[model samples]
Target: MSSAEKGLRATGLCREFAGRDGSVRKAVDGVDLVVRPGELVSVLGPNGAGKTTTVRMLTGLLLPTSGSITVGGYDMVRQRRRAALACGFSLGGDTGLYPRLTAQQNLSFFGMMYGLRGDRLERRAARLLEEVDLADRAKDAVGSFSRGMKQRLHLARALLHDPAVLILDEPSAGLDPQSAASMRALVARLTGEGRSILLTTHDMREAEELSDRIVLMMGGRIRTESTAADLRLAAADRLGHVVNVAFADGRVPAELEHCPGILGEERDGGTVTLRVTDGAASVEWILKTFPGRTTSVSVTPPTLEEVFLDLVAAS
Candidate 1:
């Protein structure tokens, strides 16, 4: 699809800042990213990995040193207002909302800023309050809400304009497990309604569960991009599967390492750990080879955390 037809697109995106000592720092290097209609793309990275910088550039909140951004066909730099109208972002922190204002008032204020008026603004705000499950707290001051509640309000405010694309920066950053789960459910529901989303977060499990695709960033550049399942498979292919075997007498057989599918082996106390190309096949071999000597065995596939760590280390 064409750039304009796409939900959001950025090409050669870069941002730089001058250090206190007069040296130039590239907060974001050249990075190209896209989120198609109805797709939720998660940008995963460690702290200082350019995620926030990229998001800011995409949202037109910060100017890029070089490159271009398009939101629903409008150039984010040259046609900033139109692009801004096409996208809404929930950038968590203490800055986005008026803490002293009620939730409804905040939404009304932003809605007016978006050129919404009268009945249209009120209806939209009401719908969003219910959508974010904050209908009962609509009149409560934002400063009185919990972090999770505030986040929900942030989401509601972002949706006030009913933009085609949503940018969420660590939506569940400091939320408790239950609160995080609620946020995730809200995200899932939004995407289900065919809204495109660009989510930047360090939460690996959340990315793995919610994203249609994941872009792994490191040191201001895109390290790799893939579907969650593909990334996990790649990790398993590169690092192999982990197999733990227990022995009855606390002794591991020396010849186990030489098995066909066994790539590496280590012994720790009564447990023997094996890295194998084919976990099931290797386990079968081990069971048959050791017979009555083996007491128990377990195999685990590569986790998303393991994959993310390996990719970051390599980068």
Candidate 2:
């Protein structure tokens, strides 16, 4: 499929709400985004930075004040019904399952909404329950399931129609390690089947692990969007290529912020913790400057957390 047909596209997206003070609050501001089929893109931002608002607009829950959105080749606004059927979104709280209904019944109910019935609905529900590791509990009421179990059920519900695009908001929230891992695996599996996924998460690790591209947002606008490797390379350029340090005798170097390529340095006892720009070449210079005083040295990979924080800080 072509780029526009593969997934979702939003251009010049903006939303404004009348504030309590009778002023306008720009919840989303001129954001542009694209997600391709079989790709998992993570949208991230600080609180009130328009992440949820953006999702709401993309999923057709709210209309954008300006700009256009398309999902699975359908215009989100002008072709609302087609767009709604093309995407599945779970906003992460309750599973929206009927608590009194058995797991099988709940799945069947949602399946029927998607026009699956009889043997097809039963087969699909059974397969989905197994996919979510809830086959054993299919006959039990959803209320009897754990929080994690409910979350998985929600995933199954979202997948009932086999939407071409999936938007998951904080899918791993409140899940235990095993449950969260399962959810991530499921997301990966769906994307492998050529389904596009737009996921939002406060969990940095989840974003780093699952997203093909990460979009960092702050103050209701995107600060940057790139792959994990691209973000690290960009941050390295700003931070520095190398760092050299000298320590005073008897006392380790105190916290010092020096050098064009160095971000910051902290001292503990006789050790200096340096946050350097680049790893390979910077270590060579550090060894020459400190010599024996350096004691020990470690080179670290750039983490998404670091890049994300730096982007937000710059914004």
Candidate 3:
């Protein structure tokens, strides 16, 4: 895609910090990222993996030590104001909102900063409050709002300027399951409206479910980028196949212990789970060794969590 058509792009992004021990540390190192129009791309990494640092630089909150950022065809560093207008950021937590102000007041205040005025500001604030399901509590103090409510309000504040690109830093952090689900649904809806999103989260399942593409970061650098499905498949290839078998009488089969193609086995109650290199060969040998002993069998693929763990371990 052309530069003008791209929602967000960064090249050779890097950040360095002065360590307390009198040395320079690289917080982010030579990372390149892209978010297409209407696509939701997640940066998945553990704490200190530079996810937050990358988001900060992308949103023009922190200048990169090296490299460039462009949002909606505007250079983030040189055209800071234009880049800010094209992008909105919701850094999850209670840091961005006023504790004493009502939800509507908070949105209105942010709208004014975006140069919105009079009826337009009021209308935008009202619409966003309703959009984030905070309209009913628009008059209530933000300090009294629940964590989920505050998070939703933060998202509403981000939309005040109707930005083409949205940047979220751990949007569901510290939320309960239901609240996290609600946040995910809202994010999905935003992408459906052709808004490009760049999300940073440590939750692998969240990334797997919500993102169109996953960028795995580790040790302050991008390790790999692919779809969640492809990463899981790669994990399966690396970890091998898993076969689970259960017997009717909860009895362990002694002969199956000697079965070929079984790399390892675990017995939990009546069920036997085998980690094998060749699933088909292992299953065949297992049934042959234990004839009528097996009551049910299942072969399962690796999950995204497994892939993430394996990738982290290898890195």
- Candidate 1 regions exceeding 4 Å error are 1-4, 244-274, 287-300
Order of quality (TM-score): 3, 1, 2
Q: For candidate 1, write residues 15-95 as lDDT tens digits.
A: 999999999999999999888888999999988999999999998889999999899888999998998998999998556
Error of 1 at 207 (Å): 0.3
What is the Å distance of residue 8 in model 3 from its true position?
Answer: 0.9
Model 1: residue 49 alpha-carbon error in angstroms: 1.0
TM per model?
A: 0.87, 0.85, 0.90
User: lDDT tens digits, residues 1-315, model 3?
Assistant: 474345999999999999899999999999999898889999988778999899999999999999999998899999999989999999979677999999999988899888898999999999999998999999999999999999999999998999999999889999999999999999999999888899988778889888999999998899999999888767776787788999988987788777666678999999989877677777888778778888998876577788888888898
**Which pairs clash in the backbone of model 3?**
none
Give the poorly placed runs of model 3, Cα more than 4 Å off: 1-5, 20-22, 246-252, 258-260, 280-296
Clashing pairs in 1: none
C-alpha RMSD in Å of predicted model 2 compared with the true structure: 3.9
RMSD of each: 3.3, 3.9, 2.4
Candidate 1 to truth, TM: 0.87
Per-candidate local distance difference test: 0.89, 0.83, 0.89
